[model samples]
Target chain A: MNNALADKALWDLRPGEAATVTGFGDALSVSYQGRVMEFGFQPGTRVQCLLNPGFGAPRVYGISNSVFSLDKEIAAAVFVTTRPPQEASS
Target chain B: MRRVLLLGSPNSGKSSLFNRLTGLSQRVANYPGITVDVASGPMVNLPDTELVDFPGTYSLEPISGEEAIAVSFLNEALADDHVSHVLCVADATRLEKCLHFILQVIRECQHHQKPVTILANMSDVIRDNQLQFDPAGLAAALGVPVISVSAKESQGFEPLVECPAEGAAPATPPSRNWRETPNEILRGTAQQLAAQFSPKGDVLINSQLRLDRFFLSTALGGLAFFFIMFLFFQSIFTWSAPVMDAVEALVSGLGEAVVPLIPNRVIADFVADALFGGVGAFLVFVPQIFVLTLVIGIMEDSGYLARAALICHRPLRVFGLTGKSFIPLLSGVACAIPAIYAARSVDSPRQRMMTYLAIPLMPCSARLPVYALLIATFISNDTILFGLVGWQGLALFFIYFFGMLVALLVTGLVSKASKNKHSEQPFVLELPPYRLPTAKPLLRNAWNRCRQFVTQAGKIILAVTMVVWVLGYFPNGGADLGESWLGTLGQFVEPVFAPLGLDWRYGIAILTSFLAREVFVGTLGTIFGIEGSEENMLPLVDHIQASGLPLGSGIALLVFFAVALQCVSTVVILAREGSTRLALSMLLSYLVGAYLLSLIAFQIVSLLF
Candidate 1:
């Protein structure tokens, strides 16, 4: 239960699993599932891991980095929690 | 002024984001029919900036029926002067799928010289997953400033929000030769791409994402349809309730205040009956109508209405029309005029006529008052049996179910003889990438519809009410309303339905409802001669329950309204779409169906209950 997978892991990392973040911020490539655009989530976003990350184009097409984008003005209403506090991060 | 677009694939959480950004700053349409307003919302920009939330789509390449709109929009904009700043929002988890669209948009926008940026939204989600993002690598490759942010968390706003748009352009590819058939080009490309990338072998074996699959597409389409429809119906009831009551009170007070000013008994009654019961009644229902139109406007602007037409196609086709014909049927539930015009999307002439003919069978809002009133009086609060079938408030649901079923039955019957039969146009739509839904487009759509409904239905209902009033007015000047020509006309018809257990009041309500279903309850309210209205519908029904009319007659009235073509506007749609003969047949068929169903239902229920 501990390598301590996070909520972002649920989007990019698998349940009861973990992955390392090598870099801080390079606008994560926004894309889709089959054709998903996983850019709806803001910076310091959480994503889950699909397959062991080595499957098909994982970086380009994984549910690991999930986010929803609304119409331009509508996107502003969203309030993302800044990277969860170390104690509160699950 | 500044401009930007929010774009991403379906269910990528784009719509939820839009709701949060603009809360009630939107207006439903103030105009109708001719031009559709898509980009019409204001966002508070830092000092000064403009935001445009484009429709959602899978890729610039068209995929599903609804998604096709984005492709066409992009293509059309390429030809026209229309252009805006682009924010290509990609999901952190599904970057590959999202990149294709981003690449396509970049390639196109760069070619058009439109300013654009890339947003890797849902950074919080990526952070939660312990995901790493290389902005330098992506920025170098796509040639657009990449900023990762979350629409839900609103993170990464400092750098990306209100940031200056990069003037550097993207590299473009050669255009295709259109003189050659589109199919010929598709065939050639399919053969070419087959050689470079392995369409098979290990790549195919490890493929987790199926770009060429139907399951994913259909699931997205269905989910969008369900979510949008669920929100629409819920909003209609919740948003409109308070406003509707306020409207009712305004007109009711006016009617009472004006009543004492008139001198003669007949004139005093006429002012209350004709004005309050006519125009006043119509105004009372406006709030519900406005709310329904606003929800519909949002669905239309977001480009989901086309998806609904696509999803509801199969079920509607069972009634003899294709997916293209489904909107008219759904709109028929709202009101019929728009439903008929909506039938224009159906290419098959016979299908259009059949849809127009059958739309009247569906109960509209006008009929709701009639059904509610009738159900209250005859159906009893308690359950009754109908020849092994249990009838309760459940009978109410069947009334609608029966209308939909009859539409199918009629369409099926008509389709058999149609020489115009054709295969369904496979619903290949471009699911517009999710974007913030704005208020301007929603408002414009609502207001336009309001003007259309008011001008169209208003005049017809008013003219008819006046004519009806005149008919009951002169000669002896209706010494007693019961003695008027209209009253005598109603009482004369009462005996014909006596077998179903109705009296003269029931006859009057039915006759008046033909003008518009809103009048049915009003006619009854006036007939009972009640002073001051009850917010509750039950008290009136309680009185009817005590009246001599049998339970069977009450139930019969409901069933008839449920299945009958009571709304005249629906008949107008039929005539306008096809011919006088066609409209007449639609009317005849519904009247006959109504009589037969209610007769059988009443007879069976009377014996059993």
Candidate 2:
């Protein structure tokens, strides 16, 4: 419920930036939320943006040791808090 | 027989492990959802025990058709009395991402009172990447026996095979509290276990990211994809031409030597015309099928297919399809039977139906011989562009492109016409780490595909050829084809194809092709051989050219074949996968559409030239 953290979505992070998932946006339907969670997007899990192929294509993200390509709309529905740039080195 | 179920998330090496234990090659690949059905075989060492491999699933909550198959099968297998143990496979390198599924499987086993063991696959990958993982520690935490096994290197099988023979105990009694944990808490528990015992670094992800930087880049990725596709289409013609010619020569030589050995005139004519002329023509195209399957198998095993799907999402979405549809559509190029099976991975029902509509239009290999004969007869085979390209190969490429364009157009029009306003499921796909493709399994798979193509299509083509030969041979003893029964029947349907400038001979080939598309080539071969030719040994293409068929008619035939749903097997599979009504409607509509378009093509060509 923190104002600054709630303002950011996973889609806002650029390449090399890491973030901790807070929760899903209200825009996502309940069933869709469950589907996303089953794909390892639960709250408190760390996710890093790896690549954003330009021209409005899906961007690549690394969660744990696995990589998944998610389109823009789905990426925008997951809320996250970006880590400090220096602390995101790993 | 005692049954042990093998279950895991997609691309987790479950199929590979099954192959290793049971010694049955079940088509393992790096792409997800390749194993769309359940397969079982007796274990190699323990013949009394059966190993069952289910299609991969993310969780018991099904999202796609294939996953639904896996979940429903699990429920049935668990309730059955013959089932004894469950071996849950997890990717050792991606333990944290895999643990949630493993926990769900464990909980399900507890509910059914079945014993479960965890087999952590890809331990060799962890070692090669210079990472650490403690299988013993993970086993203690989950209170289930965990063994690290590498299906790639055949490592750690000694312990894996022994667990089942000892009658594995129901995952320890002391962890009853852990077994009863709710689903919400199980997610956190999976993370905790992975953090404590799994490999701890970004080395694997970093390596995969380096490759994705080039393969998933905006400009470079598009250029690379087009280049690879061009090579793929070009090689289908260039690589297989020599083998095709060798097959043609061998069949004809054997016919010439053996046909004269039979002194009776009737039997000699049958062997020469039916066996050598009809079935032999279809055999020449088998090498092309093998080459096509090999290249597609290479792409699937190297993990480039997923990257290609990502690159295609934007363009495909415009046609009411998702990136996942790219796999099935491309598979359609080889054959429609497996391509229809591949559509189970698409999550949305509407999008999957759209994909089914588009799949039959993709230029499958069965149509390759028909197009090749037409092109060879009409277009000169001379090389152009400073000898860098062949005219015939370029024609093949353009024909393939035209078929794909029509598919996209039809799907786009359907999308615009439908009144449904519901939102589609999101596009989320996993990109497995790129690996160098091994040559052995790929060659074996391609060989198996060739054998399958021959056996499945061979029976139909042979029967149709025999019927055509017998009907054309009688009534005048091969003296006048016009007096034959097939000739009279063909003339009956000749009016249907007359607008395209085709005669009764072409009419008969088109009619019989409904049994199978490649039969078109074989039928033509049989007809031309019977119609009083001293040089009947000439290849079908030469015979076609010598007949002086108009260029307009040849081009019209190409267009007709591109649009028609001629294969009965494709229609049957479509009916089973979709609905009987949907399949029949598609069959009728495409037949009408093909005739109209070909009429237009014939008119346009005649006017311009």
Candidate 3:
């Protein structure tokens, strides 16, 4: 996949897909950005989408050996570059 | 005296470790942010040393009010001269995230010139998964003492207990780089250290994900959540019925055995009418409090509460609340004071306010005696499902559900009416791994909560009972209670409740209950005891039935108790936690709303029956 196609919001990844966190989106406030980072969502961190409870509910993501449930809006503010399917599977 | 500050990320088993080291039960649970306040206790072996447990936080930079409290107190404690050691607890299974926090603490401790030691908790969990964690290697790498301990099994506590006495070394000096951000540097360091020392494998996360697939799924999760809530209310009545009845029997039996021995009629009347009849009626419901606390403790310990919060988020958002509010709302079932304290965990101030509005409406245990007495009088104890369920228990369930429903509706309307429709707060909740709740700590917590209820509320109930007894007994010497001082006062308030088809006796009970919800039961017990012509004591439920109270009035009483903000402690707590204006408005509005709603309920029930 092209780099443009791989770069998207953290919420865009499906379960079993992996991504490397690039940076935060502009929509997240300065304070919330700090909070997201403090929760171990720094650049270069690997995040895996774990569970997606349907109907736009918060989805679970695994980061730094801890699981966190983030709603759609917050998840969208976290920008990540999705790895290719083969690489994610590996 | 020297002091040790116990600190860590939320759900790292920090408070539990503190309890083990200090031999104090300070309410540890599986859920994060359980300890809202700083609790200090003396170390078991070192009598002169104190161990202080701060509220859990993910970072020195706080996101919520509770974390802010932990951070602020940490700064103050580090500055205090009496502070001798800093113990940072980290989860062995999730060391990367914990190490991030540990690194922050080390930075702070180093600046303060205080010694730091890391307690890697949950050793048993890693061992169970056959995972390896080299604490010695981590200690060598981090340049601080790393002690492996299990708060659950009480293992490796000897080293932990003696760390302060041995005077563990401070962390290695910080090597700063002027270019990069400190957080980024710390994060990078934590990532590397955790990769080397943390338990290898994805066993824990994989297991948690398997459970989440079921508990957080759409259709099945909702069904399971409702079923668990139904069982919660059902068990409160079903499990405590035998214990409640035993308490009732003991009180009356003791009254029978002891009251007659007093030669003076005045003292005997005081003992029987006030002590046994009044306070004893409230005491009968203490077991129900135990059961309520026990059930909540179980849910909190099993780690299903966070999943329940996640499940509740979408629906709760409709009412301008978040899934995080679910914890405090559920804790409201046990008591509103702690529930208000728990609201600190909710990040959004607006949603926290909405949670505060909803908490007082949750059917608390204080209202249990009133509901149980009313239900026992009005609803028949018919058995169904092979006696696994009772009609009375089902009635209790509906009352609880009704309160929660009304709370949501009120928040929905208020949120819709309020301005600022676009300021949405983020909802990021951590899902702690599920663990089987141990029976010992749960039972001990339940027992301690029961004892607290008896001691804290007991004094108020006893005082109110005495005042009511004296007011009703004087002038006529118990011959005619209707002409006594309490009777006159009740008559003055009779007009207020007359619309709901209730008499002055119920009026007085409702009025006195404003002091505390359980005092309603005791107040009614005293009035009924004085009004009864027989010498032997009868159960309050029987007294209600024999008094010829209308069905509409009984239903109205239930509605009133369900809606009213009767507890003064809840009001004081709201004032302390939020604002005095919020507390007073809630108190007045709920009082009027309870009256009007109960009147409507009486009219509807009267028309139906």
Candidate 4:
């Protein structure tokens, strides 16, 4: 995947895919910004899309080997660059 | 004594490592925030050295009270002269994030001149996935000794024990130029370490995603969650019955055999009826506690519990409780005491308080015997609805359901009343990768929880039983208990309960139940002119049934027990967790609410009967 074209928000990734976190965008609720950061969601982090419970529930993501179930609202605000399936190593 | 402290980010396998080293099971699990207090034990290898396990945290910012405890304890230890080394545990599978916390620890250890070692845990996972982690490479990069160990598999601990005390300590801490944005600095450093130390592809993520597909599927996930919950609660009843029977038989047979060994009539009756009957009643429930804890431990350690919490979030949110509240609330079914302790995991005070309000009404195992005895007394044992359900079993389900309903309703009302118009706590939780729960730690944890319950609550129960025994035994000397000192007290409270068709005997039982709910059955057995051993439950029920007591009164008592905050231990915990006022107000409101509701139900049932 081309790095320039690959940059997309976290919610853009499908389940079973992986990505590198670019940066946390400001679209997330103010209350969750501190928490998302505290939980290791930041630029240069590697994350994989784990699960999205249907009916618009929070999407679960694996970042830095820790699983975090993020609300779709918050997931949409986290920016990332989608990595190719084979090279998506932490 | 020199102290070797085990430190790590939450859920980073620190407690498991501590347990492996110390041989003391200090509550290790997959979920974060299990250890809320400091635990110290003598190391097995270095017997002269003490090992301490601290609560987990992501950063030193200390967002919650438990995190504050961990950070402050570490700060204090850094200033202490006797502390020898700090062992930082990092998950090998998640080294990037673990490195961030390890870097912070390195900085602090450098400042204090204390030796530090990094234990990269979960090496078994790395090995299983055919991935390699260069612990030596990372260790070289940081100027610290890093040992690869799998606490679960019990591998790679020899080097840890043989680790030298005079090992490398960095001459200086990392530069603080990037301290303003700690995550950025940590992230950059973590990225560098990951590139050099870890393998080229993710393995666990794929397996975890495949598992989550089925477990977190909307339709199937909800069904699985409920199925597991039902099995757990059912097992508590079905699995415990035989053991309860055995305990009952031993106590009753001992009472019959041993009372004659005493010559004096008064002492004989005391030994046979009071001591054996009263205490044995509480002991019968021990097996059930074991089952409840074991099931919960499995669910928690296997990583299925987080999914249950996720599934419960939307539904529970409607009642103003976050998904995080589910563990404590479900745990409340076993015992409210630990459930209250588990509520500390909730970051939001408002949500936690709401959970606390809902907990007491969860129809704990303490109330099981009381419900069983009462239902058996009045309801027919035969199956109903063309053998679809037993009347007694349905009654049990309804009683539990009734309590849960009231808990949710109260939480909803209180959430509305509370003044948290702003700052809703987000439910961003780690959905830990599924693993086969190791039974060694799970059973050990369950055993510890059971032991804790027996030691802590048993003291109170035994004391209350003996007091009630003494109150009824003396003055008239075990003859005509209605004329005893307890009788006078019972009469004083009798008027308060007369509206529900109960006499002073039942009134006294109700009062004693305030100490603990299961005591109600024993108290009733004593008052009904029989030994209070569960072996005599049938006889006690027969006595009440033969007395022509109104059906409405039996149902009313069940209702009262369901809603009342009768357990003293729960009240004490509530006070400690929240405030004395909250506990007192909860007690007063529930007491009044239960009485009024029971009274109304009794009147309605009486008119129909």
DockQ, all candidates in order: 0.05, 0.65, 0.59, 0.41
Could you tell which candidate, 1 or 2, scores higher by DockQ?
Answer: 2
Clash list (residue pairs), candidate 4: none
TM-score of chain B of each: 0.60, 0.81, 0.78, 0.85
Interface RMSD of 2: 1.3
**lDDT tens per residue, model 1, A28-54:** 222211122113222222322222212
Correct interface contacts retained, every candidate: 0.08, 0.64, 0.60, 0.44
Off by over 4 Å in 3: A1-6, A84-90, B23-37, B124-137, B152-159, B170-185, B188-200, B261-264, B327-353, B363-402, B415-424, B495-506, B512-561, B566-584, B598-609
Q: Where does candidate 2 chain B have its weakest 10-residue lDDT segment?
A: B27-36
Q: Which stretches of model 4 miss by more than 4 angstroms?
A: A1-34, A44-46, A55-57, A72-90, B24-35, B164-184, B191-198, B248-274, B334-352, B365-369, B372-397, B419-423, B515-555, B568-585, B603-609
Off by over 4 Å in 2: A1-4, A26-31, A83-90, B24-35, B169-173, B177-182, B240-287, B327-353, B364-401, B418-423, B447-481, B501-505, B512-558, B567-584, B602-609
Q: What is the iRMS for every candidate structure?
A: 14.9, 1.3, 1.6, 2.5
Docking class of 3: medium
Best by TM-score: 4
Candidate models: Cα lDDT each: 0.55, 0.79, 0.79, 0.77
User: What value does the lDDT take at residue B576 in candidate 3?
Assistant: 63
lDDT of 4 by residue, B312-398 (tens): 777787788988899889879877877886787676667888898999999888898899899999899999789999989989999
Listed in order, each prediction's TM-score against the native is 0.54, 0.83, 0.81, 0.84
> Clash pairs of candidate 3?
none
